[model samples]
Target: MNRISIIIPMLNEADHIDNLLTHLLENSSKENIADIIIVDGGSTDGSLDIVSKYKSISFFSSPKGRAKQMNLGAKYATGNILYFLHADSFPPKNFDTLIITEVKKGHEAGCFIMKFNSNHWWLKLAGQLTRLSWQACRGGDQSQFITTSLFNNIGRFNEDFTIYEDNDLIARLYDRKQFVVIQKWLTTSARCYYTNGVWKLQYYYWRIHLKKWMGADAKELNRYYKKYVC
Candidate 1:
């Protein structure tokens, strides 16, 4: 039987963690889930206290990086499939069954098409673009699901990247032609766009993607991110 282990890497997400946990359990069948692992990257906002209240979830502390945190959680996961989610993203109803259905259909890996929880015109346009098969439209907020064996075979999420780790993994999956886009909507928080202004944040993201394509290393990418996004 294929069971999915949901892995979430978060830092200082105290505002959303509890609600996200509740939403996840309510949307999917517990029988289809092997475990829900939450890996924290040194949170100081009492996120740990909030997470500990959920007995079904397995929580651990790790060095402050999403890639590293995800890898650690994955190492302890016993499920045949792994679902990597963002703390502020919510998948569609019966999301586990949706993923398992795709897997059973011979699709090795995929993510739900995503929308931002906002009404901004630009963001709406961005969400619409995600429906395309082009990899340029992809981002981490889509919530990736992959078979554990295939995940390991791809060398897992690249720990060397402080950013663009998701893109890196997705790019590799695209290279192998092992990727798909489920025709469902996942809603992700647009808090970053709100905090940084929509246009500014979007521009920064585009620049980062361009830099990565132009042969920038992880350290260089980190520098650009720290300079602008952070």
Candidate 2:
């Protein structure tokens, strides 16, 4: 049986981690999940305490950065497949089975299409676009799953990235034609878009993509994200 290890990297996400984990547990079969690893980046919001209370979760601390935290979690994962999920995102029911089925079909890595909790026109359009295999539509919030062997072969996510680490890994997977966009949809929080004005945030996001395409390094992209998006 192919079991999956779910790894979530979080920081100050007390608002959603508990509920998300509970949802995952409720939706997934215990037999399909080998482990749930919650990698905290020095959260001050009692997130670690909540994670510790969970029966089957393994919690650990890492330096504050999603890339570093996820990489650390992967190091300790024991399952044949690693599923990197966001604290605020929820995958569809039977997601583990879906992923295992894909792996069985020979896909080495992939992510589900993304949907935002909100029903705004633009958000809906964005969600619809994720159905395409185009790389521009992919994001960390969509949630990623990869065979452990392929993950090791790709050297995992680059810890140097403060952001866009998912895209970086996706790019390599695309380069090798080892990635797919599953037909299922994952609903992710639109909190960031809500916090920052929708149009304003969207524009800046496009700008960041442009900058990255223009050869901006991780630090440069991080700087832009902190200044405009965060």
Candidate 3:
């Protein structure tokens, strides 16, 4: 049987972790989910305690970057597939079945179409764009699923990226024509938009994309994120 290990790389997500876990446990079957691994990046909040309450979950800690945390989780996974999810993102019902069906149909890796949990017109427009297979629309919040074999073959996410890591992976996959965009919708938090202001956030995002296109290195991207994002 093809089994999936869901890896969620988290940091100070105590408020969202429990609800996400409950939803996953309720919607996914034991036969499909081989393991649920929560990789924490040393959250100072009560996130660790909340994760510990879920006896079925496996937990691990990493230094601080999301790429590092997810890589650590992947190292411990025993499933045939790895589903990298965000704590504030909710995949549609039967998501595991959807992914397995796609993989069985020969897709090496893919991500769900996604919407921001906001009613802003701009955000809605951005969400609609994700339904397209355009590489520019990809983001970490959409959640990624890859066969373990393909993941190993392609080499995992680039740990050097402190930001724009998802785009980097998607870019590589696009180059090899190994990426797909599932039609299912994933609802992801708009907390960043809300915190940073929608228009301003969108502008910075475009700037980052432009910078990457202009050959900005990972360190430069990280500096931009530290200065403007968080």
In the range 112-161, model 2's lDDT, one tens digit per residue, is 99899998999999999999999899899999999999999999999888
1-230, model 1: which lDDT tens digit per residue?
Answer: 98999999989999999989999999999889999999999999999999999998999889999999999999999999999999999999999999999999999899999999999999999999999999998988999999999999999999889999999999999999999999999999999999999999989998999899899999999999989888
User: How many clashes would you count in candidate 3?
Assistant: 0
Q: lDDT per model, in order?
A: 0.94, 0.93, 0.92
Clash number for each model: 0, 0, 0
TM-scores of the models, in the order given: 0.99, 0.98, 0.98
TM-score of 3: 0.98
Error of 2 at 198 (Å): 0.7
User: Any residue pairs clashing in model 3, and if so which?
Assistant: none
Specify the poorest-scoring 10-residue window by lDDT in model 3: 164-173
lDDT of 3: 0.92
- Whole-model lDDT, model 2: 0.93
